[model samples]
Target: MPLLLLVCFTLLLPPSLTAQQRPTTDGPSDPPARNWYHQLGGSVGWARNGNNDFGPAVALGIGAYYHHLRQFGGLVAGAGMGFELMNADREERLASLTALAEYQLGKRALRPLLRLSGGVALPVGSPGQSLDSRRAGALLHPSVGLLLLPPSGQWGAMVLDLGYRFTRVDFAAADNRGGSFEREVSYRRLTLGIATRF
Candidate 1:
């Protein structure tokens, strides 16, 4: 009976000793975790004005974004500005501002994303050359893309985006005899751009 008690005491004593000897210095605690990210990227795509007889037009844009990484996915928001040269003959310059939102799937190196954007577009230069009074109008964009995260400890990643954009502009023209006419221009764009995230 004494030997049995001695064996039981030995087994319990080791666990208590191990617990007492365990390190308690709290050495650094793994640096806490970061849950937010910032990204910047540029895009180039094509635009077509349905009212005009022009072929596919081209546009360029630059944007910055902020993302909150969550358990299910990431939420993204950002703003961008872009310019487009429309039609072959009109050669009109259009400037735009965009507000963006995105939902990203997966937390892996490569993830798929859906994006929506809306804002305004204005004529850059003298619309008087083509019309009398020109006004800026609303714009909308929706997109699907892929995001490629960098390897561990890297600074940048690649983004592939495909989207469609729509914009409208209103203008009025005056004739020589003090008669005026009003018209609207609608633009539809198919856009694709590659960007980097940091």
Candidate 2:
């Protein structure tokens, strides 16, 4: 969709908005020099399966990332790995291990962040859904969010994110009497969290 492409551009593109500061006097001398660090974050949110099925559910996650404030000579970039846990409905509980990458555009305390994540997930618990009865599936998620940081020396930030998640998992009959089938689930996700640099 066109909307998806727009989000990607906003995340990966250079700063053009007047609000974000442009390097003054050139030569990277203006912006403060603390260019790299490690960050950790945790979030809690809601997820919706399909419009007609499992309308609402709970989702949670935690992550660790390596951040480069001056990536590519000044662009902000981050890469990490994390885990996500969710329940689409009463009968399905899933957990995923994902690789995450993000690019940000900002120079002020408030900035826009775009991220993409991919990995695999499996059912952790649920009636008729267990390690023995289910197969791990692929997971893909893309999100756009705002990262609000304090002044240059500050060590923490507040984040708000909105994104979409898609997954496919297969399950077989408990007794193997019926053939296996795949369940493709898509979700609209909204979360709030905090991040701290180390």
Candidate 3:
């Protein structure tokens, strides 16, 4: 019996020693916050008025965007300058500022993107002149588009956007009674750009 007890004690002591020597683990810790995607490039996009009374027109400008989540979807604000031609009756030189909200696909390295934007434009000249003018007001435009993510390892990042904007303007010449009425203008464009992660 004493021999058996000694043997049992010997076995138990090793286990105890091993237990004391082994390190304790606390599983995994929290992960860091996700990084944001940004883009800087030139775009020559088009616009189609909402009224359906007009066709697609072209606008040239440089655009830069940063993604954020808040009111509206994800907010995006940008500015562009270009020549705006209405029907055969009118055309104008203009500058625009815009803010938009977007819904992102997933948390993957490269995410699929969808966005909506609302912004205003300021007319530079009298209606269609490139010179200059003191007449300035606000024109509202809204748009929707798709953004493609670049491959993290070997994939490409592309931004393909199609959006429609609505705007209005009132000038003394546009209204016969010296009073101004709101004219509905539509805009549509396909913009391709690239994005990067920092």
lDDT of 3 at 68: 34
lDDT tens digits by residue: candidate 3, 22-108: 343321111123333334334444444344336544453334444332322333333333334433334544455555555644333
TM-score: the better of candidates 2 and 3: 2
How does residue 191 of candidate 3 score in lDDT? 46
Off by over 4 Å in 2: 1-39, 42-85, 88-91, 126-129, 173-198
TM-score of candidate 1 to 2 decimals: 0.60
Which 10-residue window of candidate 1 scores lowest in summed lDDT? Answer: 24-33
- Model 1 agreement with the true structure over 1-198: per-residue lDDT tens digits: 332443344345543233234343432111113444445555555653234347643543332333332222377776666666644344456777777788875444455677788888876543444566789999897887777655445466677777777778876766446787776777676777677665
What is the number of backbone collisions in each predicted candidate, taken in the order shown?
A: 0, 0, 14
* Worst-scoring 10-residue span by lDDT in model 2: 22-31
Question: Which one is best on TM-score?
Answer: 1
Model 2 C-alpha lDDT per residue in residues 1-198, reported as the tens digit of each score = 433654564566554432245344322222344666566666555654345455543454333233333344324455554444555433556666666666665454456667676777766655555435667788776777765654444345555556666666765434345554445455345555456644
Decoy 3 TM-score against native: 0.42
TM-score per candidate, chains pooled:
0.60, 0.56, 0.42
lDDT for every model?
0.59, 0.54, 0.40
Q: What is the lDDT of residue 44 in candidate 2?
A: 58
